[model samples]
Target: MRKEEKPKIDARLLELLACPLTKGPLVWDEEKSELYSRLAKLAYPVRDGIPVMLPSEARTVDPDAEPARSARSRRE
Candidate 1:
């Protein structure tokens, strides 16, 4: 028996994706399997490698928080 591998979001797709609300760039958090929009202060989920870009689907994030700030810094 073989183990199933989890799907991963494509790099090109990430580059093209943006926050639906602020239209700002997003940072990918591989550990959390979510895309963070610092400008919008939201974390959009990535289910089965498909990103749910809808603002309603995203969870509110604290931009000043350590984790959120770390994710943003990693991108820069």
Candidate 2:
């Protein structure tokens, strides 16, 4: 039997996925391979190319602070 393939996410989809916290959108950092939630100010890591979207998997994000790539990735 052929194994089912997990859905592949791309830059476009990353633009669509949002952070559960603060109801804010997510930004993908291709260089660091992490997902950043602008509103939540938390950074979620991508494992083996898959984004761990769960809140538990997400680290703390200081909404008042700026990420290194915040200005650039805000649109992602």
Candidate 3:
């Protein structure tokens, strides 16, 4: 059988979560499967249905333009 897709994050938990460093809002990014903390400039990854919220585990992000949509979008 094919592997099942990861489950979506629970709405309650998503609403309660915020950026650990900045204590700012966390935006759920479905396309890249990440939780973006715009103020902190970090993108926490969602792996195996769980959000990895640690700052050390977060990837750097660009606020002006999302890297996920930048390249292809700019070309068009």
Candidate 4:
């Protein structure tokens, strides 16, 4: 796959996948190369065309853009 090219996540496979924590539906973030569970506030990484579904492998996502917004404010 191209470096900037978004992974071609199969819709059918995504539909079959769920958050291991919440068992909730996940949103595919093609840009970030992750499957995000908003309910769980967790992002599962996709590496080498594989979904690392392990919760231990998952990481927390920022709930808001505080850091980015603060940096922008300082620049202005």
Query: lDDT scores for all predictions?
Result: 0.73, 0.67, 0.72, 0.71
Task: Give the candidate order by descending TM-score.
Answer: 4, 1, 3, 2
Q: lDDT tens string, model 4, 1-76?
A: 6777666567677778888988887777766678877778888888876889999999898877212221111111
Question: Looking at model 3, which ten-residue stretch has the lowest summed lDDT?
Answer: 67-76
lDDT of 4: 0.71
- For model 2, where is the 10-residue window of minimal lDDT? 1-10
Clashing residue pairs for model 4: none
- Write candidate 2's Cα lDDT for 1-76 as tens digits: 2334333348567667777777687766665667887767788887766788888887886676545664335463
Tens-digit lDDT string for candidate 3 (1-76):
2355644666678778888999886777766778887678899998876889899999998777654432212111
Instruction: Identify the candidate with maximal lDDT.
Output: 1
Order of models, best lDDT first:
1, 3, 4, 2
Which residue pairs in model 3 clash with each other?
none
Candidate 1's C-alpha runs over 4 A off are: 1-7, 66-76
TM value for model 1: 0.75
For every candidate, C-alpha RMSD to the true structure in Å: 3.8, 6.4, 7.0, 9.1
Residue-pair clashes per prediction, in order, are: 0, 2, 0, 0
Q: Which stretches of candidate 3 lie over 4 Å from their true place?
A: 1-6, 67-76
For residue 60, give model 4's deviation from the true position in Å: 0.3
